[model samples]
Target: MGREFIDLFDKWATSYDAAVTGHDPQYRDVFENYDTILSEVVSNSEGNVLEFGVGTGNLSKKLLDADHHVIGIEPSKAMREAASAKYPDLTVLDGDFLSFPKLDIPIFTIVSTYAFHHLTDDEKGKAIKAFNEILPVNGKVVFADTVFESEETKQEIIDQAKDNGYNDLVYDLTTEYYPMKNTLQSLFKQNGFYVTFKQMNKFAWLIVAEKQ
Candidate 1:
């Protein structure tokens, strides 16, 4: 089901930005504060960064501007094409987050924005484990995604979605997949990373984890 969503995104890649602009303001914050979030985890001299789901080169441009050498892994061919066209020098690969080809180079930081939620529970665990295996000691993993505070809030989000004509957005079995603070911290800890989370809004969280 999630793979189908990825395929849809691939097809929508050409007009992805335009289709999303103003239609979903929640995602806009993720793009807007991307630089600030990256700066929090990466030092000026941080080298060899990897970005998952580098859709349309939105966050890739910011990482490149920060002087970090970036390699982006994206599953969608259309999205990757858009990114390649926009940033011709970028190293963008068409791959899934769970099975992205590992680079032999030592990684300093790994960043993913709005991409984690697309993973299933098992996939999330595998992805985090893979991240831990690839990242060097003290390397960082920063992820930002939508999170629900409580069951009520989660229901509210679903209700809002239905109201907004997104009744077909029920791919996940439970909305609880969007982890709360404690759940996210525990997941990171279980994956051998020390975690810190900042509430970006009522429905969004920015989490930074350092390899242990």
Candidate 2:
């Protein structure tokens, strides 16, 4: 479903690693504490993770390092190739959140980072519903992404980016489907999850949604 952005991701595959490592000044805040954020996601994750939008497999690498079995789904071929090159044994497949290869095994947790913003709120709801269908009770969804406190906060951040002359960041903030915290809480509750958010950095929040 997020395949529309594949070309951008394919183009970003080579440089994405550098950007996340704080080499790109414009996105520094967006990816603030990159390694720590990935580590937090890995720590919060449970057994058998289904990671959507596994760009470059940063989180996947950490999960494997922690000895967690991970299945990664990504929409970009170049990104898949990049991760595969990094971890030749990791199973990264071509897919998106809403429609990935069906898993034969049960998933204890779903983990993703910086990628869920690609989905609109409605699409996110549908994806969560799909996740609910697969996961047993008490299973969790641990995601670390750019989640704002409110619409005002979102707009203020965008305006600040504009004042900094970060036109590219502004464009990304405007184009992507990032959601507010309260809205996500309500959405998760409606779909039978008790979700909590922990601020990881200026932009990203670590969300743990336990299926109830």
Q: Which is the leading candidate under lDDT?
A: 2
Off by over 4 Å in 2: none
On residues 58-97, what C-alpha lDDT tens digit does candidate 1 reach at each position? 6788788878889899888888889999999899987777
Each model's RMSD to truth, in Å? Answer: 3.3, 0.9
What overall lDDT goes with each candidate model?
A: 0.71, 0.90
- TM-score of each model, paired residue for residue: 0.83, 0.97
Compared with the true structure, what per-residue lDDT tens digits does model 2 show for residues 46-141?
888889988898889999999999889999999999999999989998899888888977799999988888889999999889889888999999
Best by TM-score: 2
